[model samples]
Target: MTQQPLEPGQAPAEHPDAVPLYGPRYRENPAEIFSELRRTHGPVVPVLLEGDVFAWLVIGYRELHELMGDPQLFARDSRIWNQWPNIPPDWPLMTFVAYQPSILFGEGPDHQRRVDAMSGALSEVDQFELRARCEEVADALIDGFAGSGEAELMTQYVYSIPVMTVAWMMGISTTEIDGVARDAVAALDGGEGAPAAYGRLAATMQNLLAAKRAEPGPDVTSRMLAHPVALTDEELVPDLLLVALGGQEPTALWIGNTLHLMLTDDRFSLTLSGGRQSVGQALNEVLWENAPVQAGLGRWATRDTQLGGRHIQAGDALLLGLAGANADPYVRPTSGPPANNAHLSFAHGSHGCPHPAPEIAEVIARTAVEVLLDRIPDVILAVPAEELTWRPSFQLRGLLSLPVKFSPVPATRS
Candidate 1:
């Protein structure tokens, strides 16, 4: 059966009991709500994003996998979204869904061009050197707070390592790293002043691109400039921005979430307490249970279809719920150890994250956490874990702060 596209100027129908994806309730413990959603609505559930916009949320592992793999049927280019013109400029989701000339938002041959250029540039990065730099940064960050004995891990350690590492990869100078980090955070949060924040971030990338063109280095930007794809500055800038943002934010969140699991959950704590699970195994558990990216970008339907028993009209938007799909009871057993890379946290198919393979991300995260643990073996949460607050963003799942206490030790790095 075919479902007709909603006529222009007509409002999409609302699901009276549809869950809102962002709010204090959802942020506090999304897993619970996700489980309830799966039980009540099966795989494809209707959801309300900010601005009361309606979209289909794919929660079943198999359903999300099929949708991502069949990109021809479910396109990534937001330009084809039939109701984009009607969405307000200030709509909360505009920052994510609006058309951009980057690999992330393109489709078909255009997507191939952008991804090829991006993958080529990323391939030039020396993984061994990258890991060493990450370790050095992690040690230095830990050194800064080692003496204080009480620090917020998110701000002091987890967040800084990824940004500084990414800055170095892009050949951004020490002086400019702070500014770029601030703007990147603002842009990702999509809070008030997000537009201005995005402008500043773009301006920073533009300047970086110019400098790389003038004096090319071994950085990713220089490699991109030298690639045969020959992306012009306009094309080069957004892709650079995508790589930097994509590399930093999710990795930071992964580290923080993994640390949180080790500190709070007994199963992970047992692993840390000399049980069977290694840090890498614990990290995989986090990937399956509390993925950094809760939901993926919207994929527009190319033709009328039925998904998980719900009618989906052409041009309708669907969001792949990574965290929710990972929690789907069908694929993941409630009692067993998590299988490595079994979840859609990084997504799959043509739109999967091309750079920073999952293995590299794991190394970066594991190294950071291991360094902190080695330096402060007795580190524990300063307050009850339940009291910790989470960032209230639809796209990200991370803590705002993770205050920890440990015996003061001298700075590890001079």
Candidate 2:
């Protein structure tokens, strides 16, 4: 394969207010950047993703709401994107924008079938059983570092909870759980190894689908295999990939963000660090202020239309500005209390993370946080909060590490 040009004639230079959506400034302080963008460029601002990929970033609360809710105007399919012609074969965002048979890019009847299959399969996940599994995984993870007195919770605990539970839900045995988690992280992290990692995960899902076909069970894979609408192995595999990979990173970050908040903010610290008190509020607050998945790959315009006082041409891609919308004063002026989880953290409309998925994620996130705090009540930030660093990605907002210190504890097992 040959490399091609990188810039969209990169309009940031041409469109002065067109904010380049990458760089240390954006990564280090996205809120400040969003605030500045709202003040200077208003809600629907012209932006450049890395490689000078031009797209719309819909930051206004109502505007984002309308964009997501009204998919008729803004379609979910990326194949309609006008910018595809200019995108290089090796483009960094190819995985995000690439059209797939998966639910992520599906539209109309196809989208509905996939969503129904996914939602129905997810609905079969018995919450109580899932909780027990989570507690078991959480306990085992905590036991690993319990005697250390000091540990990096992100890698050891926060990250492990979701993947393992999701693995259990998918009927993956404990032996193969680590590889599933490892591959999911690498594939989504969008590095040089991402393509190969993605291939490995896809292959794993195919094998699972085959097994479920011959002998189904009480698992997400088997349930999807048994969905009424019926999906071919080709159709089912991508959605399975979605469930497997999707459940991990964001939920892990959600737990990490909530913990970071509980530790740093005195308002919730005393209660949150102690036990279950204020845990729910802390989680909700983090959803509004520090959404794990800050931005979604987004929607393409079906036809030319007006949005946020700007003309949007047909096929123009619009990145769903979830974090920005959550912060929008017009929609959620006061953030401390969730106005019924009105935040677009899970996105909305046809293409949003379907029912039971967000609930499931919240369960995993909340359980992870509560169990960790219960096990290590004395945990505190190993370094000053300001000294903590974040991974450099405009799409996901998460701490690179969550190093903490606590008193050494006797292993509950052995």
Best of the candidates, lDDT = 2
Across 1-414, the per-residue lDDT of candidate 1 in tens digits comes to: 334444433435545666677767867888888889998999998876775566789999889999999988998878767666567787656778888887777888888988888888777788889889988998888888899889999988898888898889889889988887778788788777677777888888899988988999998889888889888898988888887788788989999998998888886665553422467777888888778888866798988888888888788789988998988877776687467577888899999878555666776788888888778877889999889999876678899999999899888666
Best by TM-score: 2
Residue pairs in collision within model 2: none
Error of 1 at 254 (Å): 0.4
Give each model's whole-structure lDDT: 0.82, 0.84
RMSD of 1: 2.5
Off by over 4 Å in 1: 1-11, 270-277
